[model samples]
Structure formats: structure tokens, C-alpha cells
Target: MASTDAPPLDANRYRQDFPILSSVLHGDQPLVYLDNAATTQRPRCVIEKIVEVYERQYANVHRGIHWLSDQSTDLFEEAREKTRRFINAPLREEVIFTTGATGAINLVARSWGDANLQAGDEILVTEMEHHSNLVPWHQLAERSGCRVKFIPITDEGRLDLEQLPALLTEKTKLVAFTAVSNVLGTINPVVEIVEQAHQAGALALVDAAQSAPHGRNDVQAWNADFVAFSGHKMLAPSGVGILYGRASLLDAMPPFLGGGSMIHRVTMDGFEPAELPAKFEAGTPPIVSAIGLGAAIDYLEDIGVDNIHHYAQMLTQQAHDVLEEVGGVRFFGPPPAEKAGIVSFTLEGIHAHDVAQILDQYGVAIRAGHHCAMPLHKRLGVAASNRASFYFYNTPEEIDALADGLRAAKRVFRR
Candidate 1:
């Protein structure tokens, strides 16, 4: 259900802000870009913000007494504050800037996992997790001799939550899972899972790469130990992401990377790590990209994330209806009402790559693969599928265009 508060989303009006949405592909065809689950197109505002930083205020953040450095440092920290507010994180110090969600998860797996986890400890992730969420845990397990267990997904592409009770025991040190499946579009109940993890004495980490751009993620309400999301997936530039850790937990964990800006003092004996955020940040952070993320957050808040969520769901429902009429289509995951704006499907007698090629000729761009969830593909008994993921800027017309493109692909393959 849509949140009751926000005003209705005017997708058409907002589309103008995203300059790339008006591009002409294949020389003549209007571009219908729907690969949002991978990464979203940035608005003009975010783009300009990046340029502004580089042009006027480009300097390495922290420890510089000069004006340029001070300007850059302020912008960088201000971005962190913006991220904290956006996710409703309890403190600005809790927010750390990293390369992307992968970096964030690895930070946790290395720092916290090394300090807290030991041999025989368990980490529970779901079968539907993107590789970024799964691989780190596997690596951590390999390093710490901790066991990695998966929460199985139903045939309907949802986590079989009933098994959680059995899986989450005292031995489980962490429960790391995706907020939404990149391929399946299944929106896992973050709050419910986090609560269960807590009850079992395991800290919960949310991979919000798929969910953050579409809706509000109140970290406080979820009460998760850590939350990670990429700026690129939410209409900002790449090379920047947020990691929100609980204040108490962050205070206890060791630094993941040690270098310049991360140490308070250096000596012949040893070095003391800097405070929260900086301790994990290490080296020069993505100064411009982080500022761009702040601008993107501003743009989202102005339009209201709730409105974006409702609009994307509506577009997703429309996609499901239109694709059904295209014939020879098999959809994955739950119905659109129960999921995000991602629809993964396969066509009869046509390979996913072939379908994707035909769609591209029509200037319709969609992802066609396991979408970094190879294990999920193995579970679903398919090699890969064509995915059309929507965002707030997507329209009903675009969904219809996707259907028409699919029909074209079918006719071509039949020939």
C-alpha cells in the first residue's frame, strides 16, 4: 500500500529533470531506459552539483588549513549529514562513505566480523541475495571459519520466512540480506527480519541497494545494525555509497581500512584510528560523488520518496498487465503489488540475449542476465532472464513499448 501522507507523483513533470530520459537511441528511436535496478539516471541537478564541486571547490577532505580544502571537507561532511537524515540514522557519526554498497558490506564483514565473529559462528543470508551481499559473507566465513547458511526462497521468489526461526540461533552472529531482490523484485520485510535477528542475538545488516531509491528506509524503525546502499542506484553518481551503523556498535568495531585521514595520530609504536565514519572511511573519500548523492537526496525528498514508491509500483503493475498480453512470457517473483518495479521474465524459444538485442533495436534498454544473483537463477532452474526494472520517471507508455518490443522479438525469432 502507498503511504497515506505524500502528494501524488507527477512523473511526466519530473521526467524533464532527468535529461537522459529524452535521448534518441539507434539514431531515430526514442530511448526507453528501464534498467533502474542496476543503476538510475541522474537528474540535471545532481550532475551540476558534481561539476560545481570540481570547478570551484576541488580539494582533498580534512586536515588542510586552506580554503579549498575546507570547502571540500564541509561539503563532504554535509553529505554525510544528509544521508543520516534521509535514512533516519540516529547520528551523523554513524554514517560512513564508501566506494559503494559492496565496500560498505565488506567494511562490516571485515571490521565487525573479525572482531566479533569466531570459528563455529554462523551468518545467515537469503538465497535471493545479490552477489555483493553473499560474497562478503562467504569470504568472511572462509577467513573466520564461520558457517554461512542461506534462508531459502519460495517458488514465488520470496524468502521462506518460516525457516528463519530455525536458522537464526545463538550461534548466528549476523543476519545479512537484501531489502529487495534485484532480479525477483521481492521486497523483503526488513523490520520483521531485523527483529527476528535481534531476538536470536544476531545483528542484522540490510543491503538496501535495490530498496533505498524507491522508498523511505527509516533505519531507526527497522532497528538494523547496519544499512548499505549505493548512490548510483538512486540518481546520483557512482563511486559513493552510505553505510549506517548503530552508534554503540560502530564504537566497538575496529577500522576496516587504515591510512590517511582515518588515523587520529601516528607513531613508531602504533596509530589510533579516527572517530566514527572517518575510522572506516580511510584515505580520501569520494568527495564530489558524496556531495552529488546529497543533491540527489534533496531531489528525492522534494518529490517525496513515498510518491516515488507508489508511482513505481503502479508502473510495475502496468508492466505485468502489458507483458501478459505479449504471449509466451513467463514471469518471475510475486505479483507486482507485492514487489518492487522489477519484472524478470523469459520468452519461449528465444534466448534472453536475443530478446534483449531486439529490444535494443527498438531503443528499449533492459537488463538480461542473472542480475548478479546467479544462485537465484540456479534455484529457479533458468540460466538467465530479461529484466525490465522501472523507476519514478517511467511511464505507462514505456511499459507498453516494452510489450511491443517483446512481440517484435517473438516474430523475429519465429522467422
Candidate 2:
């Protein structure tokens, strides 16, 4: 378990480290960034690391015999090591890099799902899953003739763990779920769910895109079979992510994408796939993006992820309190105590888009609409909701600005 005893974060001071945080928007308004669940702003260290890579050591990895290739390969593999430690996976070889979390999920769905699942086999996913987690399995089901089942969500936007038992059966081959809901912000019990999947004789896959960046993440502690998260969500550049599969499972599964790097030997008759990670990481990997993720991990480690988690929680609760004071704001998802630093709400008699536009006028950034979880939004009984997600760099004053923006939006809509 992650220690919650770290010193609280100092957002006021840390804000100086992010270049984009110093920007002004819409004339004179300061940019109040609250859309962290979508993506995070990069620190100067991470940005500088990317620039250094491009200027000094940019080259294709593991292909050429030249010195540059060796240098690039070393850096690339070092990034993989950083990812392995970041999630506390037992083996570095278990970590596979891909385009993003969506790509990782798709790789698992096609590579493992196609090989293992049969016509009567079942894939269990939660209703609050982002479309990336849902569509991959659905596609796998369509191809392999397997059945897809949903673990329902409660009225409070939490997984109905009581219904989980009835949902799992012998036919269930895999249980894929989100560690945290992108829309609802509900933090699901990853360890508990992984254990349940094991008991039911099914493999477990966790979509950690939302939670991995915020707190301590240990795949061994969770006893999970597969865990996936994106670099962009965690302050790295876009287009790079991680998939950590148990070595035993990965060794048994075939490669998802076949290309030059993923093959050990290509014959006129057939081709043999490369070992553990390379099997999934076909073609050239995202070299610079992976290094950026490693740098981002370094930045987070220095500050302490537990501290980030704690302060984000404080900001979340503050948002709830201030938004509640701003009447007509109906919050979705569990109360602040039960969730992370995400507050999704719908203002009475106002469309989410209009609210987002009004908030932008005040230079407050927030997300509006289903937020890539259409089913979760439908469960909340709203067409769309305004989401204000906080990170460790956000300040209390920004939450106040969010409330002020909502008040302004309400005044405009009421007229």
C-alpha cells in the first residue's frame, strides 16, 4: 500500500516549474488548468529531457550497428526499466511499450484474447470503463465469438461489487476493468477485484490510465495479470504507454503486431515472434516519448506520488464544497471522500458545453461531455457533465475561480 503520510504538496511553489502554467489566456486571464484527467502539463525537467534527446541522442533503437543506435537502445531500455519500477512490476521484461493505453489494451485483446477465448468464453468489463477498455474486448468478442458481460455500476457511480460474483463464472476467461473511472472518478478496489478474478478462474486486466499517475501503483501487490496506462495522462508526451503482463501469460500468448523488430527469424514459409516485450512492441517504439515518460516519472518520484494523491484529494473536496455553495450544480460520482480529484457535475437548466464556454471566458479550463465513457455518462442520467479534475500543481484559488465561473454561467443561462 502507498504511504499517505508524505508532506502536503506546495502547489504555489511547484507551479513555477511548469512553463505552460505561467501562460495568460483570453486576453488578461491567468490559465486555471483543471483538466488533468485528460492530460497533464509537463514540467521543465521533462520538457528539457525531450529536447536533449532530440538535440544530442536522437536515433532509431536496436536496428543499426552504429554507435547512435546503441546509445538510443540503451536510453530506450532504460526508459523501460523506469516504467517497470514506476509500477513495481517484478520483471523489466514484462513491460511492453505501445502507442498509448488504448493501443496496449487492443494488443491484449487481440493477442491474448484471440488465442485463449473460445465461442462460449466470457469477458467481463465494468460499465464505467472508458471506450478503450470496452471496444477492444467487444472487437475480440466479435472476432472469436465470445460473449461480453458488464459488471453493473451503482447509483452513486461505483461498481456494484455485490453483483460481481453473479457476473463471474467458469465461462469467464478475462475480467478487464478500470482502476479509476475517467468520468465518475470512482476509485475501484484493484486488489480485491484481482483476487476475485483469480478465485473465479479468470485473468484480470486493469486500466490504470487514471489512477497510476496519482498514487503508488504496485502490480505485484495488486496481484494483477495485466496493467495498462498512458504516458500523456501522467505528464509525458502523447503517443507512448505501457502494458505490464505477467511473464508467464505473455510467454504463452502470440505477438499482436508483427513487423521487423518483433520477429526473431522471418522465413519464406513462416516467421517466429520475438520474446516477452518485443512480442507486443512491434515496429519502432516511441523512443523520445518513452524517455519523456521516464523523466516525468523522475519528477513525480522526487515530489512523491503519495503527496500528490493527498493534495489532489484536498483540492477535490474543496471543489465539492465550493460547487455545492454555488447552487444548482448537481455533482455526479461518489462524494469527495470516496473518489479522487475529479468533480463531474451538471448545472440545472444549463448545457455542459455552455458551462464550459462560460468557464473558458473566465480562463478556467475544464472538460465537458461524456469524457470517453458514454455508458458511465448514461448511467449518471445526463447527456453530458462538466468535469473539473485537479492535479498536485492546482491551487485553492483555482477552485475558487471554478466556482466563480459556474456562478457566472448560471447567471447567463438564467437570463
How does candidate 1 score on lDDT? 0.92
Q: Estimate each model's TM-score.
A: 0.97, 0.97
Question: Where is model 2 more than 4 Å wrong at Cα?
Answer: 1-7
Best by lDDT: 1
In Å, residue 197's CA in model 2 sits off its true spot by 0.6
* Models, CA RMSD each: 2.1, 2.4
Residue 174, model 1: lDDT of: 91
**Cα lDDT, model 2, residue 93:** 87
C-alpha lDDT of all candidate models, in order? 0.92, 0.91
Supply candidate 1's per-residue lDDT for 29: 95
